[model samples]
Target: MDHPSPPRKAPTLCSLRTGLALLLHFCNVALLSQRVCLSLTMVAMVNRSEPRGAPNASLAAPLDNVKNPVYNWSPQTQGIILSAIMYGMPLIHIPMGYLAGICPVKKVVGSALLLSSLLSLCTPLAAEAGESLVIACRFFQGLSQGTVQVAQHMVWIKWAPPLERNRLTSVSLSGTLLGPSVALLVTGFVSQSLGWPMVFYIFGAGGCALSLLWFVLFYDDPEEHPCISLHEKDLLRSSLAEQVSSGGKSVPVTAMLTSLPVWAISLSGFAFSWTNTIAFLYMPTFISSKLHIEMRENGLLSALPHLLSWVLSILAGHAADFFLARKILRLVTIRKLFTTLGLLPPALLAVSVLHPSVSPLSSVVGLTLASATAGFCMAGLMINPLDIAPRYYGFLKGVTVLIAMVGGLISSTLTGIMLNQDPDSWFKIFLLMAAINVTSILFYLIFAKADVQDWAKEWQGTRL
Candidate 1:
């Protein structure tokens, strides 16, 4: 028998794909900064009563001198404003997810960044214009940013090889955590020194600049990229030949809806979102109330969880790829193992932070570790859609994120209501989050898979 030819491998050199992931990292940074900018600045924007002579002199001095108009919005009102983007997101995710397949993903994502930037610019004016306009602006911003989120899945579909999926997606999506990490670290100082409105102005203008850069750099696929090397192109073409197909086939809507793996991804996403939403949007407030940290310190400290999470997510990506490459476990087993690692520890840690005897330093440490551990899920559910349905990954992502964001909406609203009724209700909140996290992981373990579904395969009979 003739010996089989060795598998083609791309040269170990600078990769356009890695550059693309980095560019996407910046794009994610810009977009998510817009998303969380208000979360941090809202501390300065809302004139909540602090204890007399609270050590927020840095923030107070700016307000006292600049006379930045602070709103006396109630807790419920603040919750509504924080959750406004979630409302806009649901309206656009499914449509944009479908559009990601048919449209130029670069244009869709670039335009979204531009729109989001413009909306961020308008946020202060909208706040001055009235609460409704601010809410409307945020809703539209959500719609715009939602497109970016859905479109990225399409980019991976075209660019990411099967074995490299975890690394590429993790490197790119790490921006999600990194954005908020940077935002929280800076927004407090910006709000204090330049006025709260400058927080929006600065991030919004940066976003617009990034959009221009995106137009110059991003391409939808390898063949379309003028600068891609022949070696890299050939490697991608051969490696991805099985996982992707030429265009024109309709998405198998009914089959995808009925797939248990899809449900597993969606529900697991919801579980993750419930906790993540609270962490991103409310952590500053939680710290202020519980630890009595001032705005500047609050911002710096609040960023630690997400920063640690961001770092660990990138590491988890590499670890995941290592496991996959080594053939140490089946694909489904690796995903499930990582998902368990992601969910169970964090759930227990979240509840631990509620202990009465836990010092302020210990609470912060516990919360930071919990957030860091949760990053493992990025290797789990975040990339599973690509494994099972690369052909319709965008559509699958849209559906999954829509369901997941419902948890965000509910979590924000419920947290607000609970806190509003009784400020000392964090115990209840942590319990609920832990319960949801555990319950969802069990379902994911039972149903999740890594094999490409029948409908996702091309006529060539290759599978991802």
Candidate 2:
């Protein structure tokens, strides 16, 4: 009787607790797996939508007297036309982010794709119409492009879990880099073989294809995914429920803006974006003008740096996750570390301009290294929004992007002014960028921290 009465109450209690823990862990794993599968599929679909065409071809065609009827425009004009998208991005991204916050992500993304594709298809028509029409089309293309970028970020926030977020984000964002690579390579070939208009036509067709795929496959949340398995759906609901129970509500817009860390990240983003825009929007021109390279050569050379950066970005993303898993660095520290390291090279390379004897190839190589280093910053700044506030990541991202667009606008205008004034002292413009990069790094080091601010958590509770 005594033996029966004592029958392992401790063991039973331990067994129950163990079972619950196992169940919870399994739920998290299952939910994460489902999210990963869905995210990968969506990212692949989104990646397909990026504009890629012959880089060399796109550049060379406008210079060719026979193929390019509008060859009368100067290189600066061509650069402006090509870069009109970056110039208009900041103007549109803020509203686009808010729109994503309110609307269905799938519809918003798909609609943007459809509109962008339609506009891309019409780009050739604009060329035939007139320069003003072409400029107008470029502006429209920029608006649509900005919307697509914001929508994709929003979709990732909604669909991806915390653990998988960085890699998934990297994969999604790699489209920006990859799109240019493919465009440079393919467009180079297509523009050379077929014509400049064919580049837009091909990208348009691809965009339309991706729009259809997105409509078919994407859902706003796991609860709504028709193809999700019952077990998987249950797991997702359970995991999300736990997060909802534990985490505070979405942080209010006003409170988020008031936070120091938010501005720190925003400032870092501004510098990072300006550097990226300079490289992406102006590198071709730099190679052509400074290096005395022909347009075709510039396109091929410009593509190399981006291709290098794309690879580096993927690696940096994975490396960041690995470092986080080891607890070697907090999220904020990791961002700062990578961002500081990445930013330094560009600043140094800009100063390399002091030595004018450097060969064009050497200059390209220096610029490429600078760009590749900047790619690592994406691991920090690009993925930090998820680290800070998963619930309002889309909105925060919108804010950061809006801030960053100021840099983009500055880059475009400054480049124009510098070129108009004395294109040779482009090194001075680089020096200005270097100062911005250094200042941003210092700001982030001082203000950015991984811990959720007490004010932020309290505000989230009240707001939600």
Candidate 3:
């Protein structure tokens, strides 16, 4: 008996649907840029460029209160402002993800991001009004952007072919690194010369524009897209045969809550987010404090690490797909390999920073290398939820994100507390991050899988 021939390969490599999906993912992350810009730009906004009525007057003054409308807040207050987003994010993750999984996800995502941009634009106005307004603005921005991860998963389940899953996911997720890098590079100059308000205005407006463009071009699924090719559509549907949900999945609360794999992924996210939150929120400050590098220079230098991270991240994605396509290793083996690569360098690098003899140049290089390792996570932690539960990808992502947001909040707030104690206090923080990194990876390696969990399929027929 002859077996059926393999389906004929489509002449097209990737269709318009693929391009639109990737670009839409890229735009979704531009919203993340607004947050990074604020973290870096606030430094320039609050402090003068030199010392006042003295040598280096611009740098010496704690505030250019007259020109900059500076807020000379204490570290505790600053921490609260910086971390306000996390406050709203964890609370909304389950709701946002639940809705995105059931609703017209593209519209839901677009509207959420649009609201974030509008809230971002109102930030300057909020600052002008009072600190409370600024805090409220950030809180609301968090609430809006919180749904973004799960919403994108919703899009990807419909768009990524099985073989192309790593590529699409990694490339799209690299936006998380790329957007923030670009924002860091640009925010300081805009804040320094044009004023901090200009940074917000530029990034916030770009996010708003990008969100509208996304709505115009992207559909939630292949069937709804006006421009997708037939072969591409067939490929997507066949590749993701099991994900054809009717948009009414009963939340897999019991399975996700009990699964070792889910818990592993969730804890991994927490560890990664904690280390990254510190880096994201305060790397510039750390460099400035240690090396006396000015804020603009700090911003530019900070960009290098994330720029490398983005490039390496997408490359890691492609590499993972290549290994799988060649049948070079088992899927579980591949994931563990990448997760090992992704987590250890960062842990070791974090440990290096604690050494008293580490030079400024070495410190910077170490952190950059750590970032490069972080890129490999695309092959593992970042994409594993979809691998394990496409049907519940949204809710799985939401739960993981909710746990991770707490990590972010604690890191941000604790960093402020540490900064006040002494420079040596950084040693403890670095040690904590390193411990979290290696420990989380062990949990992932032991419990993670490269196949779908049973719960993802249990109610599919009944719902779809």
Which candidate number has the best lDDT? 1
Model 2 Cα lDDT, one tens digit per residue, 363-425 = 778888887787787687777766676556666777888898788767766776677567686
Looking at candidate 3, what is the lDDT of residue 172?
Answer: 80
Q: How many collisions between residues are there in candidate 1?
A: 0
The residue pairs that clash in candidate 1, if any, are none
Per model, state how many residue pairs clash. 0, 7, 13
Off by over 4 Å in 3: 1-14, 48-67, 460-464
- Tens digits of per-residue lDDT for model 3 on 1-464? 33344344443245764586568657756877877777787676454343233211233244554335565455556677888987878888888777776788768878888888888888877877766788899998888878675677777777777667787788888888887788889987877777777777887898889888888888776887778778777877777786655257577687678899888888888887887788788887777777789878899888888888888888888889877877777777878888778888888997896588988889888988877678788788888888788777787788888887888888888887887666557778888888988899999889988798888766733321
Ranking by TM-score: 1, 3, 2
Tens-place lDDT per residue, model 1, 26-73, is 889988888997888888877677432322222244436453656657
For each candidate, give its TM-score against the true structure. 0.93, 0.80, 0.91
The local distance difference test score of each candidate is 0.84, 0.62, 0.77
TM-score of 2: 0.80
- Model 1 TM-score is 0.93
Q: Pick the candidate with the highest TM-score.
A: 1
